[model samples]
Target: MAGTIQRHPVSPVSALRLFFVAGWRSNLALFRWMRPSAFIPTLIGVPALQLIFFVHLGRYLDTQPVSYYALGNALHACAMAGLFAPAMSLAGERFAGTLPALLATPANRTLMFAGRTVTAVLVGCSSTVVMLILGSVLTDFRLPAEGIVPISAAILVTAASCSAFGLLVGAAGLRTREAILLGNLVLYLMLLVCGINIPRESLPDGLRLIGEIMPMTHGIAAARQAFTGSGPVTGLLLVELGKGLSFLVLAVLTLRFLERGSRRAASLDEV
Candidate 1:
């Protein structure tokens, strides 16, 4: 009995059930403990400032600077929320002594992680919408009426991609502090290379290549097209969705590798 592992059958319905219950509780706990002043600044203020500063600078050079910076920074805000918050939450679980119990449970860790992503996506989307509204008011930018559905789809894809990348970051954080640092580095790199402020075409060949693979690059492009009603929204949104799902698969593999390598009775320590 002591050495035996009690494996429960994997059920899709049960997994969904677990995800909803645990995910909601986790989000509530996060909000309850984090102070409003500190949380608001990180979630909204920092990204808003970035939006304003870039838009102001772009005004001098581009005729449609408002459109570029407004949408770009909105996606950037979503990326920050989706990428950092979830990773930090997972890392917090480790420090809080919940990681071992969580891993030991019969529930699938990957599904649990996905469940947590629900909140990440919601928060990311909410942040983007707030920025878009605020930017429109202050900068005289107008949201496209025709492409509302496409824009919404684009936001969801962006959130999905960033959250998938966050899973990788969270998994890595289980091992070292350097992983969280790496997440920060990736965020800034996205801004530079992912056409957040500068066009991907002008990023030099090497950086341009990097931007193509970054999560928000295609998503931002799709969002922009949706905003301007300029390009084929379905194709771009689908591509962005594909990228996000691919990252999620990679994160799953990474998590599986870490779990497999975990030692007996010291499983969490090994991870």
Candidate 2:
């Protein structure tokens, strides 16, 4: 009994505190490398410019209403934070030579990585709001007073879903240096297929199927419906929520699998 070590379960409060602290630190580390000048442009300016460009393009083509492009691109902008942030944060640990130390800790691995998504979702929502405001000011985009709550909820869900998918990209980064590249690839794929600029009906069946299973499709649809007060939004929102949960599960499983493999091979920090 003299050598016996008693293991105590982590209290709920302690777990909550750990989740909060991990999320806060993860967000800080995410932008620590950038100067304010670069950071501001990357976060706000790039997305704003993107929205402006596409809105004008849509106007030139004379295909859809300005609100269509505005809402679509604004939702798409969520990925700038939702996808890139988590991938960079997780993969950055390897780049910074800290993954080994992080893995050596006694904390819950899932909680630690998952907490990082909180800030990502917050930043994503902020990005969405900024895009919406810009759309309203620069174009004919308008949200009815009653439509605000549903649209806001749809944005939050979409960001969470995108962050979940980003975690999967981050998990892959555990072993490779191409995580950012992969994130960019997925982002563009979503842009092309997920009804951001072009309507889903315009896409080929194969691409439409791909978009159906992806994150932003349903959320974008739900938000659009909410804005117009046309169709039932609850169904779309539920499907979006389901997509997020699926990605979240896959990310956690992929992370755990990679973590085990890396630990077994003594390659946790090899990137």
Best by TM-score: 2
lDDT of each: 0.80, 0.88
lDDT score, residue 173, model 1?
62
Candidate 2: the clashing residue pairs are none
lDDT of 2 by residue, 1-271 (tens): 7633354578888888778798778678756734678667877898899899999999999899889999999998888888988899878888889887887777877778888888889888998899999999998678999999999999999999999999888899887889999999999999889899989999999999999998899999999999889988999999999999999889989988988888788887676
Give a tens-digit lDDT track for model 1, residues 152-239: 8888889889988887887776666566787899999998999989887766999999898889888889889988877788887788
**TM-score of each prediction:** 0.92, 0.94
Worst 10 residues of 2 by lDDT: 1-10
CA-RMSD of model 1: 2.2
Cα error of candidate 1 at position 58, Å: 0.8
